[model samples]
Target: MADYPILAVVGHPNKGKSSVVSALTQNDQVHISPLSGTTRVAQHFSLKLDGETVFELVDTPGFQRAAKCLAWLRVEELPADQRPARVAEFVEQFRSSGQFFDEVELLKPIVAGAGIIYVVDGSLPYSPEYETEMEILRWTGRPRLALINPIGGDAYVAQWQQALNQYFSLVKQFDPLHASFDQHLQLLRSFGELDSRPGRIFDQAIEQLEQYRRQKLEQAARILVENLYRLLTYQQSSSRLEQAAREQLPELLPAEISRFNQHLNWLERDGQQQLEALFLYHRLESDLARLEVRQSELMDESQWTLWGLEKKQLVLVSAAAGATLGLLADAGLGGSSLFAGAIGGGVLGGVSGWLGLDWFKQQLPAWLQFSAEQHLLGPVKDPNFAFVILGRALSHARAMLARSHADRERLTIHQAGDHFMQSLEMKVQIRLLKQCKQLVRQGPQGQAAEQLRAWIYQQLTA
Candidate 1:
């Protein structure tokens, strides 16, 4: 790993040095706080790909007595070529002393071979007080980059940039809380430009990081598709059935429906957890609308538009699906010679599609079935149910993808206007509809589910 880049993140207290490390490594476990002296010692973290460390970052304590340390270093008349050795002597002298503990810890990595990343709050006005720390770091003679973190706003960014340009070879504005993946890659690219020693290695690291992200997205798609299948085809059966249970089953529908909904929620959450873990977000929390089937009217029109398809598009798709099912059933019964069954099925399907949630309201009891020997809750009958499940999964997955590891707040998944299903071409929509029907009948193990997973991966990449 000596051939790979090692960057020492040095800064004043509470200026988002740890936040930069968190975002760069994509590790949520990194400690962060607004209070001073949060990181008290130097710790090394590595970004590894396939069990190989790509690069390393040293999260070191902020400069506690920079002015005093610099004053100590200047007591001896040293030439410019020997100044780094003087800084090294200061670290050796104060390694065990309690006076410049923070300064020694931060300078240890820079005295070694680590490149410097000096962080400062771009949101705050620049002052001469911070120059003490900057001047101390400049004495180390390490390749340096200055990250002006706009912790609040970019109002003071240019002010910081003007000052940092004098000490650092590169000055850039980086916001850890909201940086996209591309920004992260670009930042790493800039790290490569800091020094020529590991330029090719840093480029390889960026490529590996992109590949790892794509693989995680593929895994996320699989998790989401599997969850959609499970939710759509889920059934809750009762073993407490008696001979006369059919008569009482209708009364027990509410409790059974509640249990079914609970299980659905659990399944959805389980998939979400898998996705979060895949992206290395162990402590992620989300504020999302509930994913469940309502007993009153399936789903509201507004929700359908948000999570499934628009009213007009859903109606047309559902009507076509119904007519196909009707024609298939007619052919299976005897032959397609019976135009009556096909025509009736098309009209009923079209009307049901037009009715939307109202049709689901009327057919709720049908979904809750009871026979002489069996009592079951569901394999959701409505075609629109498929879109609802799929839409919610994609929403949660996309939210996780967009989130930065440096964020401490709960992820809020808003209901967006354009749904993935709604934007698809009609043929693609029809193919998805067909695959969803196959899922209900054949479970999530066959070629149909594979096709759905492939489509989901395509959407994720898009």
Candidate 2:
């Protein structure tokens, strides 16, 4: 809601205007191609100063004397009603041209309102044309600061400052790329001065900017923590089945699921490191607890049990069923092929049994674990039901693995991790919703909880 102060960069062509804007905003908003007159129109960007949204930078196109002359002609010749259209046409024509003369004709907006940032190359002697441009800019009567953009050599620094002093109120030599945060702050503070009097408005603005920046950092840190929790939780849940089942399977049995978990972990760690490197606090412990609580409430007792060894056995059985179906996925079998298929099929059958075990463990209580195991590995069991259940789980696992891989390749590891965490957060919210619904059915606390749950769900899900 805070209104940011606008700082406009204006100067002759090829004077590092885009570079200065890029440095100030820490974004590549203004295209910085080697060709002169690249910036054809004003471009705006916002950045936090101090803890507040109190600063903005506007990159204006390079000044061109010839373009100004043509524009002036159009303005004079066109009727008052047609002047706007003519002016637009003339400006467009100028933008298309390769050549432009340094002049103040293009600096009307900054002169009228915004703070002025005038950049001049310090490697060459101050030119008369630049002096003329400064004189034109001065007519707009805005607070102006001249920045000498050092290039090539330092020999012309003294001459540049002397020439700059003839027209500008203050001059400073600044390298945009190498400027430190303190130095940048000091420059903004200097701009806060107007008519030899200090501007108190920017003091509060800077403080606010700093606060906003800190908040952004904190938010990023929170995001990283959320990602880590998702990675850890998902792995813990899925691993119970994978590990136990894998050991019983053939050696070449694809370790894709395990590898996917590892990849997810790497992404979370990378995101954490990125936040830490920026000096942002890593609040992993607190975030982890929040996620765990939320997860506990979201997943049912049965689902929670899916994270254990009993559940893993079911996943193993499911994998076996999946392998058999996958083999049938490619028909035509010779004697050797059938023999290989049988061996592969047995390994897959064992995996299917493992998956079934996992599924049953989640739904059944601990007291029933032994009974379920007996039923699964027992002498009399429904082979058809086992096949169906294992096949479904295996299919889901394959799809999940593919999606995880695609996500990894499409997004940076950190971004993917963030996404995974967000998904977990949503799942947690959904669980909370169910809890609220159950409570509502019981009356009293349930009604209020349901309302609150609905509000939060709408906000988050929307």
Candidate 3:
């Protein structure tokens, strides 16, 4: 237990104590509130890797009667060595008195050999009013570290640091709301500096934590690649499609596309949920736009061009990937009737190699096909659709990675950032287009899926 290194996080009322615990332990279920006295009892949270405890954090209620409790400790003249025993006696005497319940609960772990983690709001000016609480922690004879949490802003961080440095062995500024993963590892390394006995354990925990993060990223890439294949090649059929007359399809098509959109959204959401769980986010909601296909067309310019490649890039990539001159004609290019093989050439060149929107409208029968004598509604045929799926996935993954577990806001996948796929080298883009072709023709179980997964993993790590 001594080598395990339990840390008791104590602070003033309404400070970001629970937020610190949530951030450090990577546990979101910890209760957090702006109201004072939200944490009534001490709760233990452990960061475990493969069922082995790396370390533990104790979220304890803030001090309620610090000045009065310090008064009692000073009733008798005591040497520094005897102070800890006196603090223990106070806990024993007031165990059930209900007079100093918060103090007793907060000190229980410290008395039992847990180190101290004192939290303060650096957004407010430093005051001597906090000394009583700080002095009592010093008397407990445990290694102490003070955290200046800038809950609102860092207006008074230097002020807080000057005072905290005099009270604790180590002091740091940490914002649980927005700290990055590298900052997390740095904080853990500082925890190892508190004492020599538990230093080895903390080092091991840091190594394992880094390895665990890499594994999660790899798993996330797999999820994205698999989901992309499913969405691109997805097909749905119902008795309604078979029963409807050919003329009725125009009217019936919109409803079927709506259903197809719902299923595609469902598939994408399922992948997102798996990613959330992989990263230990149990209640994450992504605010990405719904996937849709209107009248056998890709989404409008605002969405299609922003998330996927721009139309010009699409044309260049398609031409580079061996699309025929006639396929280029369909992507808003003017041509006579001489190049009639454009549609057939585009189909043979593969979906990622050409913009066949005119051909798309002229060929609804291509998407709504009669295969195996059954009318099947989709597996969207647009070349740019693959890029759209990949772009959205990269955006969502980056957002989840950048988020802190303590963040309570809904995860919004903003389209404001530069699209990753849009910035890739032309050669890589060509290779990706080729992979999309393989996935469409062969599904997710082949060599193409493996190559795509590797490429995605590289992007995530980069």
Candidate 4:
């Protein structure tokens, strides 16, 4: 057995092949739609099984019967030198021919060396065409397993199973819609049996597969939790600071807070993009598109109408808000002129929002609201104790900004400047620490979360 087992997922047209691929990979890499013939080409995605790279899934387009005359033509005309290209042409012809909904010519990868994961619709009655396809699959001489993908009722499962057993060495019924970690493990185990070259190799492969599954699952969980914490904590902290500024420095708070919030928003969005790349293995462009879709869903129709935000508009708004807020905070608007806090907050917020924090904010306060008297309102409808603390902090920031402007001499401000700066830094650090600690507590017991906590602490200290 090779170190990396290539598993090719193949089945009749509209038999949930892509769904199985998506489920096993835990990735939305392949686009799945209700329309048949979505997958026109084979796609490859690797999965870590056990502690080693032992599993690679190749999602091939759905198989369909070719017309008798067309099949004969393909058999005679498919030249050895141009087989790959000719096969692709034939597949395209069949797809456009309207004689069948799927073209089976894409199964060339499986015929080469990969093990076959033959999927079939369990809901429909077993058809002779499927049997013909299975017989054709057997001709490839690849070790194959049958996966009965249920798209409808289970009433026809017995007949489906009977048909599958005739061709496949192993048969398993799986609902791709609700596939679990254990089910995937079982599927891999069946593939493991295909390799007859006995030794510790099979055992090693199985061990590696199990370890990989566990590790991947843990990684996914960590990513989800980290993103959730980052979004929530960043939003709460930034919102509180903004609200405080609005109340304390009535003259300058609104503009400054707005600027700071915008910067923070950008930081959060950027963080989100990084997170998606790390976990989902998405390119920056695709991740950005996904973020936009999520943001659109989060923004209600009324909000969209008010902002006049198209997809590009939202991205611009988020980016502008982040840059403006970051610059203002760095320049010192409220009191302490700490460039570090301003930059850090802005980056964090912007990245988080970009990644997926738009969804998080929907659960928080509305961006805009009106009172019963038709007066525009900010984040908080009522001023509370937290609001007061936030207000004082903002007032201090404004005064510091004014003093910095008034006194051109840097060192001349001296002790007064030092005190305000130190106090502000301490407050920001404390707030961030508390948030990070809470996030760690929410995570699963693992080295990753511990490492993340340490990283957060180091960032704060730095």
Cα TM-score per model: 0.85, 0.48, 0.87, 0.50
Residue 228 error, candidate 1, Å: 2.0
Q: Pick the candidate with the highest TM-score.
A: 3
lDDT of 3 by residue, 317-366 (tens): 66665353233444443332112322334332222222233334345445
In the range 133-158, model 4's lDDT, one tens digit per residue, is 67556655678888988788677889
Candidate 3 all-Cα RMSD: 5.0
Arrange candidates, best TM-score first: 3, 1, 4, 2
Residue-level lDDT of model 1, residues 154-265, one tens digit each, is: 9999999999999998999999999989998998899887776834877888888898778777778778878888878777786653333456644655555556656767
Task: Mark the 10 consecutive residues where model 2 has the least summed lDDT.
Answer: 404-413
Q: Which stretches of candidate 1 lie over 4 Å from their true place?
A: 1-3, 241-244, 286-302, 305-308, 325-366, 369-372, 440-445
Query: Cα deviation of 455 in candidate 2 (Å)?
Result: 34
State each model's C-alpha RMSD to the native: 5.7, 17.1, 5.0, 18.4
Q: lDDT scores for all predictions? A: 0.74, 0.47, 0.76, 0.49
lDDT of 2 by residue, 189-296 (tens): 787764333456567656765565455544443433333233322322223334444344334333432343245435444544454333322333343334333323
* Model 2, CA-based lDDT: 0.47
